[model samples]
Target: MSSQPPEPPPPNPTTAHGSDRKLRADARRNRERVLRTAQQLFATEGLGVSLDEIARRAGVGPGTVHRHFPAKEALYLAVATDQIRQLVAEAEALAASSDPAALFTLLSAMMASGAENVAVKSALVAAEFDLRTAAPDVAADLTRHVADLLDRAHAAGTVRSDLTVEEVMALVAGAFAAIRHIGAETSRDRSAHIAQLILDGLRPHPR
Candidate 1:
């Protein structure tokens, strides 16, 4: 025999669907783990953390991260997209509330969520950052969701009618950025306090 190592065994002969399903399930778990790890790292270490580190923390191989998110920007977009979906859903749930003040409450709650609530800003990341350009569909969906929330509030006579959805999103993103920046240097929960102040302005005026 040659000095080379023995050849690997042949592939399994199992049905395609079974293998596909198990592979899909494993992929789903790996994706969730990666996203969760990424979210944690983005919060504690900021967004500059590496994919290898995230995979390690998530108990998966680097390949898994790459398989789910081909680029760092892809990973960032996924994490940010998930966050936006959640905030938009929460905001929509309060759409029919009798108390228009609840709209500001929703804003405060979302703004105080810190890194997780930074999705709106993340969605607006530069065209070079794989946020808007790489995923125009996602960008559109995010814009629509924000518009829905603003429309609901405006119809309820809760928030300012003149304000655009982009403006509101920026305000909330600004709160997330402020807290992240402030909390980076201090031990305080800067978001909660700052969010309250922001809410003061977002609240309805009797006029």
Candidate 2:
């Protein structure tokens, strides 16, 4: 007698939400690992590194990596997004400071950090992949943070009032490009020096 399959166990309300939370947490951890591993490999190995290799280094299967990042470009963009987010946070903190020199110094450091991530530097050369266009929200947030910092510096009579926010951003981007020309290892020092030099040009001239 197929005893009515033992009455189905009562549904556990907490079980589903718990499982979902754990799954989301695990996914985030895996995604982070993938990004870190990819950044290292790409930096040392260039964009030629295989997805399988990234997955192996990340301790996840190739399918899992693909599930999170459907293509190589997507993964690269994710890395850039993460880097920009960190830079934006730093910019926000420095925006409140009265010291223009310190603010520019911090901005240079942030660009150096981005340069260190191989994928990010490489992506910089890819014209088809515009971080600002691809990740507008992140870019806008970052731009706003940077603008605020520039405005603060200008208000303090430290920075040039004639330069627009766009001009400052262009300088920052140009700094990164120049840093890339010198290579990532030297980019930090070179960028800081260049930033200071640019800052000199931006400073309010004494009448």
Candidate 3:
């Protein structure tokens, strides 16, 4: 009888694990792409843009968007959380720098990000989804970073002496409201002007 064919080599566990990791990474990248595309479409095109359209713009299958975010509100919350995480990353970078004015830099970034995500913020608020409660860890991380920067600003005499982190946070929130009140959420220059006016109050004034 003809010799039996050689047995196939055993499966390579290393290759299997590598493929698994790559698949996971690709899924994460697709999810992130979906969130960013949804955020842009929501800000510019409004919340009426469907999940399918977002997938099309993000260059992913509609199934990918739905797989990650099953509902509109879910997408809204994810987008909002992603925005704050970005601010937290910026705060981390600012913390690493020697700039005594880093606090102002971070605050400005926060305000600018808020202006860009105002629509998503409003949607979350309407749906009664507070990020502080929904994603407390990320919210706290940003606040903690802000507090650290505020302490630096105090040592360097960059900001008003008595300005607390709570107040700094409040001012950032107020800036968002002011931008919304004046319908400047869609206008970069207008929003930046409003942000400047709010941020000015944090600086030390003449005696």
Using lDDT as the measure, the top candidate is 3
Deviation in angstroms for 51 in model 1? 2.8
**What TM-score fits each model?**
0.70, 0.82, 0.94
> Whole-model Cα lDDT per candidate?
0.69, 0.75, 0.94
Model 2 alpha-carbon drift over 4 Å, by segment = 1-3, 95-102, 117-127, 182-187
Cα lDDT of candidate 2 equals 0.75
For model 2, how does the per-residue alpha-carbon lDDT over 1-207 read when each residue is reduced to its tens digit? 556667888778799889999999999999999998987787678888888999999999999898988988888888888888878777766766657665566666665665566456566557378888888999899888777777777777777779778987787677667666776443456656766676677777888
RMSD of 2: 2.9
Q: Is candidate 1 or candidate 3 better by TM-score?
A: 3
Q: Sorted on TM-score, highest at the top, how do the candidates line up?
A: 3, 2, 1
TM-score, model 1 to reference:
0.70
Alpha-carbon runs more than 4 Å astray in model 1: 1-15, 95-102, 113-127, 180-188
**Cα deviation of 143, candidate 1, in Å:** 3.2
- Write candidate 1's Cα lDDT for 149-190 as tens digits: 677778878777788877877887687777757653133355
Best by TM-score: 3
With a 3 Å backbone cut-off (N, CA, C), the pairs that clash in candidate 3 are none
In candidate 2, the residue pairs with backbone N, CA or C atoms under 3 Å apart (3 or more residues apart, or in different chains) clash, namely none
User: Which wins on TM-score, candidate 2 or candidate 3?
Assistant: 3
Give the candidates in order of lDDT, highest first. Answer: 3, 2, 1
